[model samples]
Each structure stands twice: as C-alpha cells, then as structure tokens.
Target: MTDPDRPVAIPAVPRPKDRPGRAPAPETTSTYRLGQGPLRLPLWLRAVILACCLVEGLLLAAPLLGLGSARAVSLMLGGFWSPLLGGGTGLYPGQGAVMFLTYGLLHAGLLHLAMNMISLAAVGRELTRMIGAGRMALIYLASQIGAGAVFALMQPQAGPMVGASGAVFGLAAALVGHAAITLRRRRRSMAPLVRAVALILGLNVALTLLMPSIAWEAHLGGALTGLALGLIFAILPRRA
Candidate 1:
C-alpha cells in the first residue's frame, strides 16, 4: 500500500498561442509606416511625383531646344480658361474638361514646380500608404476636376490659370478628414485636427490676400472635394 502522507503534484498547462522565447507579433493596421517618412514612397506615388517633375523639366527644356515655346503652348492648350469652357471663346467643346487634368502638369515657373513637387511628396507618401495607390488616384483626379470647376466659375476673367495648387490643397484637406476618422477610432479628442485644419485654411487665406495671382477659389474647391471623399473612405470598411 502507498504511504498516506505522500503529496500529489499538479501539472502546468501549456499555452499554444505563445511560446516561452518568442516575441509577440506586431499589430496590423491600415495606417502606413509614416515613421519611415517620405523616402519610403511606394511605386505609384513615386511614379506620379516623378512624372510631374519630368514633365516640368521637359517644359523648361523645350524652349531651349527650339521646341517653339512649350510654356506658351501649354498655357494656350491646357490652361483652364472660363471663357473657353463656356463657349465664349468658341474653341473646341469639352476642351475645358481636358485642361482640368492637364493644367496640373503645367507650372508657372521653377519655384511653382518646386513647391508643388515638395507638397506632393509630403502628402502623397502617407496618403498612398493609408488609402492605397488606386484610391489616392481617384482623390487626386477628383480634386483636380473639382478645383477646376470652381476656378472657372469664380474667376471667369482671371486669365488662364495653370498649376497644381488645387490638387495640393486637396491632399492637405484629405489629411484633416483622415485625422478626424483616426481620432474617432482611438477615442481621442479631435481638437488637434481641428486646429490643424484651421491653421491650413488660415494660411491659404493669408496667402490669397497677400498674393493677387494665387487662385484661392481652386484651392477651396479641391479641399472641399478631398474632405468629402476622405470622410467617405473613413466610413467604409477596409478593403483589399
């Protein structure tokens, strides 16, 4: 017979989900690796930014190569003109719509080109990561068109307008909308996003007032469109 004073021992349960020496898996998120910064732009984002830069370079170099004034030709062909779109100029139909997209490729000068490329780089990387390249394309194109329409209506006599400021401003506005959605998800206060939006808008206003040549209407239009689309993205479920 066994000894009555003998003690029984309990066995330890093994955790299949975790191992003794292994680290936990990293969290999955729709958010991009923003900590990596702009240098980590994906393929599509890099393509778009590089295309703009190349186009601007070509426009600048065209004149020197005796290509018959690329800037003048670009302004005449692609620049958004209210009169031309409205049939006042009796040009081609739907020309204004074509120019809406093309005008973004044109720049007033080196400074204008540089500013737009920088802005695109800053915003495009994060946005492309968050929304994917395809959605980003939609937002950008929609912003360009919306801004063009607004500029056409607001400044019918403001002369030909050419630049990517509208699209750039739209990207900024979209970030604000994205920030709002992010704050909601984290159950955090939205005061920071609100402040940022206010600052951006205020800066736009100041620039518009100080610089007579700036097309504030286009910026406003693009921003509104971007905000709308961004909110829509935020509300929808994540997709592949």
Candidate 2:
C-alpha cells in the first residue's frame, strides 16, 4: 500500500510510425531568356532585295541566254514616256499607273542597277526598322507614283525614263524627316536635320545639273512625298 505523500510512477507512451509530416517544397531557381532582334533581317527587306537582284540579273542575262534583246526588254518592260506624251493613249485606263511602279525596277545598265540596289538596301533597312515593312512599302509606292506624276508634268516631252533614283531619294528624305521628329521629341532644335536635308537636296541638284539625263523632277517629287509621310508617321503612336 502507498503512503499518502508517496509519488506514483507513470507508464511510457509508444511513438507512432505512420504519422504524416510536412514535406519540403520542391526546389526552384529563377531563369532568364535573351531576345534575338538585331541579328535577324525582316522578311520584307529580304524579299525586296532578292527581287531587285533577281530582276536585274535576269535582265542582264536575257541577251546572253538568247531569251530576248536587252534593248527590246528595256523598251517593253521599262517605263516609257509615251503615255506622258499625247502619242497613242490607247492603253486601257490605269495602265499608266502600272508603268510608274514598274519603272523603278528597270535600270539603264549594270552600273545603274548596282548603284540603285545599293542605295535601296542602305536606306530601306533604316526605314523598315523605323516604320515597319507595311508602312515602308506604302511610302515607297506612293513616292514612285508621285515621282512619275511630277516627272510627267515637268518633262512631258522627255525621253523614256527608268531607274530607282526617285524611290532612293524618297528614302533619304524619309530618314531626314524621321531624324527631325526624333530630335524634336527630345526638346532639341531641328537645325541638324534641316541642314542634312538641305545638303542632300543640294547634292541631288548638282548631280542633276552634271547629268542632264537624270530626272530632277522625279527626285524632288519623291522627296516631298517622303517628307509628308514621315511627318505623318511621326505624329502617330509607335509599336514594336
């Protein structure tokens, strides 16, 4: 028998084997990805450059390959001044419009083709980057048409004209306009852009004077159209 003040001993409890415990969460680490933009050329630039090269190559090769006469090709595929003149306007309505765009593809010689293609690549890449492929195309087409119309108005009696000079000038002017807008956005004056544009115009004028065969009218028209388009684009919201 236990005494009234004596302590009692308690039985030890067994540990459970199947009790659930909190599991450590799966380990995770942060990851990052780098973008590829500068390395890639836009599809529109590739297509246009390739097409220009191919068209010029085929034109040059046609005579050697016995496919056709180079002169005949130039007269037929090249833009003619006939529509501008009062001579045989029998061509269906809007035919003249088609010729305006095609004229840009035709060049007088290998040298002519080379110069135009080089300028196109240089200026086109910049404009493409600035305004994107679609807008670039619109500006180009409109420039071509404006050049043709201006040339016809100024030189209705002039001989057949061909080459991408008008379009090239347009791209140059477009660059100037773009630069001006960008500078203005930063609270800067447009003097630099204006000077650059003036220099370009002066050079073109000298070239025209030196080479009377060059169509000054077309260049001026294209440049004006480009300036307008660039200003309009500058005011619009931009997207990536």
Give the range of the ten consecutive residues with the poorest summed lDDT in model 2: 30-39
Clash list (residue pairs), candidate 2:
none
Error of 2 at 50 (Å): 2.2
> What is the TM-score (0 to 1) of candidate 1?
0.77
Query: In model 1, what lDDT does residue 160 have?
Result: 82
lDDT by residue for model 2 (1-240), tens:
755454444434444454468564444444333342453445765676677667778877887988777756565655746454455462455555567867787777788778877877888878877877788777887887888878888887765777778878877777778878888888898887778778887888888888888888889888888888987887887776
- Over 4 Å off in model 1, which ranges? 1-39, 89-93
Task: Assess each prediction's global lDDT (C-alpha) against the native.
Answer: 0.79, 0.74
Q: Candidate 1, after superposition: displacement of residue 184 in Å?
A: 2.0
**How many times do residue backbones clash in model 1?**
0
Over 1-240, each residue of candidate 1 has an lDDT whose tens digit, in order, gives 644455434344443575678995554434233234344766765776777788788888897899967778778887888787566652566775688877888788888888888988888877876777677778888998999888888887665888888988887778788778978999999988789888887988887888779888999889999989888887887775
